[model samples]
Target: MKAPDFDYLRPETLAEAMDMLSRHGEDGAIIAGGQSLLPLLNFRLAGPERLIDIGRLAALKQIVDGDGFVEIGALVRHCDLASSEAVARAFPLLRQAVGHIAHPAVRHRGTIGGSLAMADPAAELGACCLALEAEMSLQSVRGQRWVRAVDFFAGIYETALAPDEILTAVRLPRRGPDSVQIFSEVARRRGDFAIAGLALVADNHMANPRLALLGVADRPILAEKTMALLANNMAAADQAIELIGNEIDPAEDPAYPPAYRRQLVRTLLRRTLMELLP
Candidate 1:
């Protein structure tokens, strides 16, 4: 199906884009990489009155490694993040997870900001952000504010972003010298969206582990019960594995039932723990 008729506005600067957004309010949809938005439009899932193109906003295309953190601009492509030396050194979990996103052609055009803003329950980047405790920068005519990854996602295809705000960048802490990262997912095929996935980061000896799971709920979620159990005592792996079923509320899908997803989550947790703790 073709997209409905819409007014297209291309903004030359970030400020201009924000102004346009402020004026259009809920009637406008911002398109940066267009990898996600185009599909929604093509399927007639979204029909904004005005399509605000901010793809050429150069200010949101940088990868800045700063003191104790690395800030990735919204327009940074998935493929670029996968191949970045700074990302590899600081956030290996993200670099590894990007490989599971989709085919190369999609990755070449998909932006991290677009993925986060879309708030897909099964997107790898959103889960990685949660594991890393990344913060998103949201800007609008009203002002700018930072939101933690855990609070940014509202639900399936929804976010905390106000209608007039744009997610400008994401700030992620640099991995400590002794940090260890792990990423794994279960999918019907390579490059397919995972039925369930895990992104974990921890200090050496698996202390202070942060485990974030995707495709197990309405949005990517931190396994707080599991993390707390492991944090309190690494020996409680068996109990922590059991806690996941209680923590996650996965909806039944036609292809994958809720029981299957819960089991997959358990298996992922078990495998990850064995690799990290054994």
Candidate 2:
């Protein structure tokens, strides 16, 4: 099936994109990478009246490093992030995580903004962002504001971004010298969406650890209880692993049952924690 009839608008500037979105409102859909949206359009699952192409907007493609954090433009594709030396130096976990996101061809076209905005809980980036406490930059014709990763995702295929708001950038704090970031997942096949995944950011197991799990619920979940356990007693990693079953509510997919997915989470979590060892 071909995409339904829609007016294609290519906006050259961020301001121009904002105005286009404001005019189209709910009827318009933003297409950055088109990795996710094009398939939906081809399947006839989504039929928007307008396609606002912001792919070429310079503001959304710029990656800037600040004193305390690194800001990635929303339009930055997976391949861009995976190949970024800056991203590797500052946040190696992200570079490692992006590798698990489909194949190279798909990565070349999939945008970080598209993935986060789509809010697929199974995707690696969302969990990584949650572990890093990345702040989402959103803008609209009215104004702009930052949303915490935890708050940005509301549910499956849903986000806090209003109809008029476009995700402009994602801000990730610099990894501390003592921090260790771990990312791993279990999937049926390589590059396929993981059945379960884990992203862990720990600073000597004393500071508050950031733990996020993917494909476990409606959205990426921060494992506060497990993190607390590890923080209080680093040796309690074993116990924290066991508590994941009780802590998260993973859905029952037809391919991977709920019990198996939870088990996969446990396996991935254990594997991730082992990385903390010398």
Window of ten residues with lowest summed lDDT in model 1: 225-234
- Give per-residue CA lDDT, model 2, range 1-278, as digits (tens): 88889999999999999999998969999999999999899999999999999999987997887889999999999999998888888888899899999999999999999999999889999999999999999999999999999999999999999999999999998878877888998888999888789998877654778889998899998988888888847688789888876688777678877888778777887888777666
Residue 135 CA displacement from its true place in model 1, Å:
0.5
Model 2 stretches with alpha carbons more than 4 Å out: none
Clashes of 1: 0
Local distance difference test values of all predictions, in order: 0.91, 0.89
Shift of residue 134 alpha carbon in model 1, Å:
0.6
Q: How close is candidate 1 to the true structure, as a TM-score?
A: 0.96
List where candidate 1 sits over 4 angstroms from the true fold. Answer: none
Q: In candidate 1, which residue pairs clash?
A: none
Candidate 1's residue-wise lDDT over 1-278, tens digit each? 77889999999998999999999968999888888898889999999999998888999999998999999999999999998998999998988899899889999999999999999899999999999999999999899999999999999999999999999999998878988888999999999889999988888776888999999999999998888888847689898888876688889789888888888898888888888655
